[model samples]
Target: MNAPWKSGSSGGRDQFAAYLCDDAAMDVLRPIVADLGWQPEKCCRGGLRNAVQSLSVTASPNILLVDLSESGDPLSDINALAEVCEPGTIVIAIGQVNDVRLYRDLVASGIHDYLLKPLSPVQVRDALTHAQAVYSAPRSHDAAGAKPHVSTAVIGTRGGVGTSTLATSLAWLFSADYKLPTALLDLDIHFGTGALCLDLEPGRGLTDAIENPSRIDGLFIERAMIRANDNLAILSAEAPISTPLMTDGSAFLQLAEEFRQAFEMTVIDMPRNMLINFPQLAAEVNVAVIVTEMTLASARDAIRMLSWFRAHAPQTRVLVVANKVQSALAEISKGDFEASIEAGIHLSIPYDLKASSLAAKLGQTFVDANRATKAGAAIRDLARLIAETGEAQADSTAKPSLLGKIDFKAMMPRTRKKAQAGG
Candidate 1:
C-alpha cells in the first residue's frame, strides 16, 4: 500500500526537482519526467551529494528526488541534504534496498516517500502524482488572530529528576486550571508512569499509532486518549517486560504535529534513551525544558544537553528547572549552579520528601495532593507562566550580566591528578 502524503492534491509536476542516477536510472526517469510535465533543468545527475551542492548555490524546488542506491550511509547523507533543502521541499528517495527498516527510517526522518530502485515508469509517475496532490492541499491554520498551538518538551538531564512529575503538573494546569485543551504525551513506552500518576490506565493507542502511522486520524487519537477530565487527556502505553519497544523518528514527528492540531498546548515527557532522536523532536517544539538538580554531576550533564540544544535546535527557547532544590545541605548552591551553566534557573521546586512520597503512593499529582505546600504552589506558578506567556523572565539577580565573563569549563571540578599536574 502507498503511504499517504499530509497535504495537497494532484496536478502538473512542472515545478518538481530530481537528482537521479547517471546510468539506466536517468534514462528511465527522463521520459517519465516529461510525461508528467516537469522541467528538464530540474532533473540532474550525481545523486544526494549533487543535490546538496546544487541547493547550496540555488533555490530548492517544491519536490526533491534523491537517488540513494550508491550511498553507504543513506541516513547520514539524507540528513546532510535536509540541512540545505528548503522548508516545504517534499523529498522522495530511490534506493536499491527493499528493507522495511530503511523505508521506516527515511519516512521517520521527514522524507515524503521512498520507491525501491531498478526503476519503473509506473512507480515514478504514481509517486510524483501523489506528491503533487499533497503539495496542492490547503494547509490548516488556527482561526484568524488566534494564538498558534504551543508544544513544550520536558527532558531530564539525568534519571530520577522528577521530569514526568513536572510535565504532568504543567499539562494539568493548562487543561484543568487555565481551561485549554491539553495533551500529555509519554514518549517513554516501557517504564512510563504518566497514566499512573494521573490515576488512569495505560492504553495501546500510542504503540499502534507509531507502528502504523497511516491509520492515525482524529478518531484514532480520540480512541487512544484516556480522559482524565473534560479538558485533559493522555496518550501513553504500558509495554510488557519481555517485549522490546523501539521508536520510529518519523512517526514521532507525525504524532507531534497531530497533537498540535488537536490541542492548544502539548506537554511531552521525553525519555532519555531516545537521545538520538531528541534533536529532531526538539526542533519541532517551541519550548524545551531541561529538568535538573543542585549537584555537580547533574550540572555536568545539564551543560552537555544545553550545548547540544544550542547546536541542533538553536531557534527553540530553552528553560532549566531546578527540581528538588536544597541549598542548606547541598554541596552546590542554586546561585553557583546557575552561574556554572551560564543560564538562570527558570523555576526552583523546593525539596519536600514527605509531600512527594505521600503523593506518589496515592497516585495523585503533587499539586493536587498538596496544593497548599510550597512545592505545589511553585508548580502552579510555572503552569500559569507558560500558559499566559510562552516564556519566563530570567532572574536578573541570578543571571549573569554578560555570558562572555563566565568560563563554563573552569567551573567544573577537575580531578586531583589534573590539578596537581597543572600546579
Candidate 2:
C-alpha cells in the first residue's frame, strides 16, 4: 500500500496485473483490462496472500490489483503484502466490505483505492482508468540518482505584507545562488504578480489544468511551465476575475504533486484565503513561511495560523518571518509580537522602501535587485538557512550505498593475493 497520491513503476514492470479470489470478479476485471490493451493472462486467479507470495519472487507491476475477500483481516494481510511489494507500486484492493470507516482506514494504511465486492464492469473500468492516471502522474525518480524534493509554501498574515516579494526572492536565491532546480507556483490565480515580478507573461497553463484536472501529467507539466532560467521554471496564471472558481481544489493538489516530481524545490506563493479554504494543499509542504509585520493584526493572524498549523499540519515546520521591520516606527515591538504569537520571529527583514520599489521597478526579485541593502542581506541569510535545512533533510533520509559500505582497504589483502597468484 502506497500513498494514494504518490506512486511509480520502476523498470521491467507490467503495465497492469491483478489477483482475483473468484471468477466473477475476474470476469468483470478481465474485459476492462483488455479494453486498456493489456493481456488477459496478467489477471491471475488468487488473493492477497498469493499476491504477497508471487511479488516476493517476481517484480511487482506498475498497477497491482489484489483481492482481499479471502483474508480474515484485511489490514494485517495488506501489511504482509507491503513487505514484499516494491516501493512506489500503486495497489488497488477489491473486497466485500463496504464500510466507510473501512475505506478511510484502508486509505490511511496507504491503499490507493478500495472497491467493494460484486463490482460491475463500468465500476472496474472507471477504477482502473483512475489507477492508470495515478500511475502516469509525474514521479520523482526513475531509478538512478533520485533526488529528494523539498516543498515550501509562503503565505502572508495580512495583505500588503510583501509575501510575493519574499517568495520570489527565496525562489531566485534557490535557483540562482544555491543552484537548486526550483519551481515557483503562484496560487493567486487571477491577480498573481509572480510572472510580472520576473518580467514573464503569465501563461494559460494553470487555467487549463484548473479546467481539466485529469489532463495533469508529466507531459502536461513540461508543456505548461514557462522556464525562467536554466534551473528555474514557473507556472502562473492570470485568469479573468469575472470567472468563478469551480474546482474542488484538486487541480492545485495535482499541480503540487507534479511540482514534487519535476523540481528539486517548490516555492508555493499561497494566499491566506487559499490556506483557509484548501487546508490539504499544505499537507506535503516541508516548510511554511509566514510573512508579517509587527502589527496587532499581523500578530493576531499569526497566532491563529500557528494554531491552525499545529492542529491541521503539525508535520510541517513553521518559519515566522517579520517583514518590513522598522524598529523606530513599529506598531508593536519585536519582542511583544513574538510574545503575542507565542513563537519567536525566525527572521526580521528591515524596512527598505527604496530597495523594494527599485526591485518592483526593475521587474526583479528583491534579493537580486537590492543585494547591497540590509534587507537583501537578511533575505540571503534566510536563504542560506533554508538551504542548510534542505541539506540536513537530505542527509537524514539518504540511504547508504553498497560502495559506501564496502571496506576497500580491508579487501586489499585479498586483492593482493589474487594479483600475486595471477589467477
RMSD of each: 12.1, 12.3
Q: How much is the lDDT of residue 106 in candidate 1?
A: 64
- Top model by TM-score, which number? 2
Query: Where does the lowest 10-residue lDDT sum fall in candidate 1?
Result: 410-419
List where candidate 2 sits over 4 angstroms from the true fold. 1-30, 37-62, 66-77, 84-88, 93-144, 394-423
Measured on C-alpha atoms, candidate 1 has an lDDT of: 0.71
* TM-scores, one per candidate: 0.68, 0.75
> What is the C-alpha lDDT profile of model 2 across 68-113, one tens digit per residue?
9989988788777776665556777888865544543465466666
Candidate-wise lDDT, in order: 0.71, 0.77
- Residues 102-204, candidate 1, lDDT per residue (tens digit)? 6545644666667766777866776677566656555454235434677888989888999999998888888888888999999988789999899989889
Instruction: Point out where model 1 deviates above 4 Å.
Output: 1-19, 22-138, 142-147, 391-423
What TM-score does structure 2 among the candidates reach?
0.75
